[model samples]
Target: MNTPQLTESIKSLVDNIDREYILLPEFQRDFVWEIRKTCDLFDSLVRNIFIGSIIYGKPTFEITVREIDRRPRKGEGSRRKLKVISLEKNEINHKLQISNFRLILDGQQRVTSIYRALKGIDEIWYVAKNEDELSDEIKSKELRDRTLEEMLYEFSLQEDPDRLSIKLADAFEISKGIIPDDIREQYFEKLSFIAGMDEAEIKENFKRYYTICIKLGELFNSEVLISYYLLNMDNEKFALFFERSNSKGIQLNFIDILAAKLYKGFNLRDKIDELKDKYHPNNLDREIIVRTIAYLVSDGKDIDRNYILTNLNYNHFNRYWDEVCELYNKVLNFLFNENFIISQSWMPYENMVIPLIIYLRESEQKDFSQMTEWQYEFIKYWYWATIFSQRYSSGSNEAIIQDANVLKSITKGEKITDRVFFSRLKSQIDSYEDIYSYSKKVNVIYKGILNLINYDAKGLSDWNNSSKLTPDKKLEDHHIFPKDYIKQQFKNDDQALSLMDCVANRTLIPKITNIKVGKKPPSQYLTELKNSNSKLDITLKEHLIPNEIIEGLYDEFFTDFLEERSKLLFELIKRNVIDKEKSIIKEYYQAPKVKGNIKIFATYYSKKVEATFDIESQKILFLGESHSVPSATNKAKFYLTGRNNTSTNGWRFWKFIDENGEEKYIDELRKLSRK
Candidate 1:
């Protein structure tokens, strides 16, 4: 139950103890460290030692002691009973036992190095060879002539006499001959001085610290036990303590923790090894991939150190394992099939959050296929656009996030479709005809498009537009139509020279190269292509022109050449537009709904009647005078009465029908009025 400080002497004595007693179960994570990082740690240690700084704060080592029935390893055939000690400390512990204990952690590189160095195990040490040593035989051969031991001995005697001399001398007589006199004398002095020392002096001066062994009267059993208690009590507290106490300043990257968590779950370390061996021989750095994943998932949020740690512990492993596997496979597939090169020129923007939206939309819509020339053009334009925009150029994580959100919205079927967005972009380009004006607008549009692509254009622009490029040189605005040829042969005027400065006539080239190509027609370059053995010329011939020409052909030659190159550039811009449109449409909008009824109805009304007119009395009152005038009054009256009766008896029937088929009766009592 108690913890104790294990000193150098006790640690050495405990080296004889069983290693198994301290090792954790298979559930414990694998040891992970890269060569570069390990080298850095050693460098730091050396620096601290030389600078006379304290290497250890609380303790130098930790030893965990546990009692359990011994069991055979997972795949072993024999159920061999054995006792072991485990060195669980993060730092080096020279005192731990090699036999009964297992190195539960931090022992991979150390154990390998120690086993090779002390046990004299054969291991290759890749070192640079002198030009004389790298003869055709050695250069051409797949396997080396000498054993690793011999090579190591050679390296030691030749390069590192202080450590390797005694071992080399014992192993081979040739080493003694190679050892310099000064080195030989130093080695002899140390050996003789040690040999002459009494037992007490030897114990005081040359004793190894038993830093892992437990003492009887200390507060804790071992540093490992205390570490376990501290870590298990509160993980963050343990991390903070570890960060502070580990004065070597060996900071663990987020991916390291993520890798550890993954190893804890499914032995992912082995899986990673398999992936590396079969797919990427040089395993992608864990930090790079982790950063990429964070960028992909976070939508341009800044990934802080603590955030990285938290993600590595939980979110990263849970969210990205399958995605990582898929991406790796996709990348490998692309590489194997000779797909478009994932050039580093577009690394920042291409790998941003918005690009993830593009990828997801493309994947979902089944738009992505094997690389075609057009796809290459599209990618190139997108890359160029993003680079020009400088979206990734500033201290604006929020801007980046906002841009990603916009991209996501577009991809999710929002207001802007790819076509509209691209049309607007191209419009912006066409609006500015002058070269400088065009360049400035294009740069702005480029940034806008980059924002759509989920990249920080400002950031990228700043970096790319820095004065790091030689100021003695300006980016040459090459006249595809040779300027002198245009002026002298075409017009012999300033107007033609002005035309040569047009964007349509210009492309970027190194200023020095531009000066060299001055006044010469394409014919001269064509001739150089045909005559020169340089592969650069050959490449230029294929890329620049299809056929060789004579000097006088300049006027006709460059005209055609500029026209074609301009057309090609125009096509590239067009394709970029199409891709952007596609990205937008895929991210937004839904289909329309159906309806059943189509017909509609309206009502009709009859004209209003005149209320002043009397229907029955009017005829009689007006007829009074006429009746009196009529000589055959009796005959007239009888005729009138008969006519009125006949008219009244003969009523016609009419009906008004509505759209829905309901009918209404019409009045037959009144005369039809024209006025």
Candidate 2:
């Protein structure tokens, strides 16, 4: 039996990372932690908060993978790229000793996070305070809620040792160069300081404070404790350990684990990546593919984890891979035809694709039109109803089982009457007012609705040129009343400001048009449009724009104008597509109070704020204040924009939860909240 080894310093781990002695396994998921979370992790380290241990393993055979340089992503908040500095090949091989490097099984997030921050690749900072002067806020327990920006000042390092000492002293506001003589030799040796008479204090409080303030370099010192398990084993045992080790931090996802285990000389992840590059549809996650294959083999009775794991053979995967890919192609085509112009953002519910794929596979129909009229109507009704009602918002596996049964029966030539379809359905959208805007583009009914409007847009660019809305074609959602105009009209009315987000104010236009139309009143843009195109009136009418607003008559009364247009848009959809059905009594599902560690990110008015829930205490520390769910939301808002008594929904305001699995939103948890 081989024993695992533990390394006890972050500096050592980082040194290993710098020299390329550590390499991420190909099966490791992409670094998906939001920039804000990265900042919080740094804060934890500076405050000496216990982030869990890391795990690593040395494989028996060699494998090749590139070191993940923390490439800067859009809106990452960090100005610096957290990617590691390049090292010479000789240095890498020499430091590594062995021919192959160790694979980080766990703590990739932590390692990369620290590397990014300390290397200044990620722009993050800790609050600096002089021990002598402490504000009331800093003294209180609530001070912990303050963000790094709120509490810390950004500074630069000096190369000259004496100058650096003076720079540090000035930053810390050490006036008169006051220093206790007894501790001067230990704390102030490299620079000059005034004697504070005969001071024989050991563990001097001021010295300790200055030490922490000037210890930013220690992040690279290899002294901060970081425990990791290093295992050396054969590929089979290593793969098994890889799949089932269940090492605490950053556990592998199902696909990640499955990919680590080779199936007939092919890794599932590589095959999926190849499929993704080939097919490239929005919302095509590995889990979705696994579920589709799982359902295909089980005949829709199960999409269980064990079922997927056991059935992921090359032969099984190869047999169903192309067909599953074709089914997804069909799904996107059907959505495109419906004017959903399928992008990940425009997709209302990914699981909604499952039953349709099951129906297509069972019915042997390549397209919806190939289905019997009754069958086509049956599946269409189910798709829309499931989306509008959000029937699977909770991601209940049983719901997929039940929904698939209904579609399979339809494929069997059992007529799905409106009564039957409506029976399983739960909600109806009588008007566009039912839709709401969220910080994220995914998982919103409004996104689906926007695609529907795009369908009616008929691919006409704002300039009246032929434009096809596709994944490649950039389309922008233009505000009918520009935000500035709305703000001017409504001032501080929260309800009215929120109206700016309503579907009524938005229309699909080409990205160029959206940019050019900036802040122009609808009438002014329309006037310009009429000058350029003979059919401006026809284009506006087709887009569901009310004639009065386009004609420049009711431009000033935009509030009433938006309300009337929403009704008009609702009527347009009803007149074209929908059949009468009663709305379901919508039930909300709250995420069970997270049982373990959880991190939440909230965005308000384009600024991001983060909070962490202490599982044991059931308290969330937001912006520096510890509180319950309700107060966290309020505090997050205050920290984000510094406004209080502002109307906001905690459910909607606090957007994302970075639990171990798929990112979930508080809004979804609310709608899916158990009774």
Give the root-mean-square deviation of each candidate in angstroms: 39.0, 21.2
Q: Where is model 2 more than 4 Å wrong at Cα? A: 1-252, 280-284, 304-307, 342-345, 365-367, 416-421, 428-433, 436-440, 455-463, 466-468, 572-579, 582-675
Tens digits of lDDT, candidate 1, 69-118: 22211123112323334444653243332333333343333332222222
Write the residue-wise lDDT of candidate 2 on 183-254 in tens digits: 344434433221211132112323433554334434434344442333654332343344433566555656
Q: Assess the local accuracy of residue 557 in candidate 2 as a C-alpha lDDT between 0 and 100.
A: 75
How accurate locally, in lDDT, is each candidate?
Answer: 0.33, 0.55
Indicate which candidate wins on lDDT: 2
Q: What is the TM-score (0 to 1) of candidate 2?
A: 0.48
Question: What TM-score would every model get versus the actual structure?
Answer: 0.28, 0.48
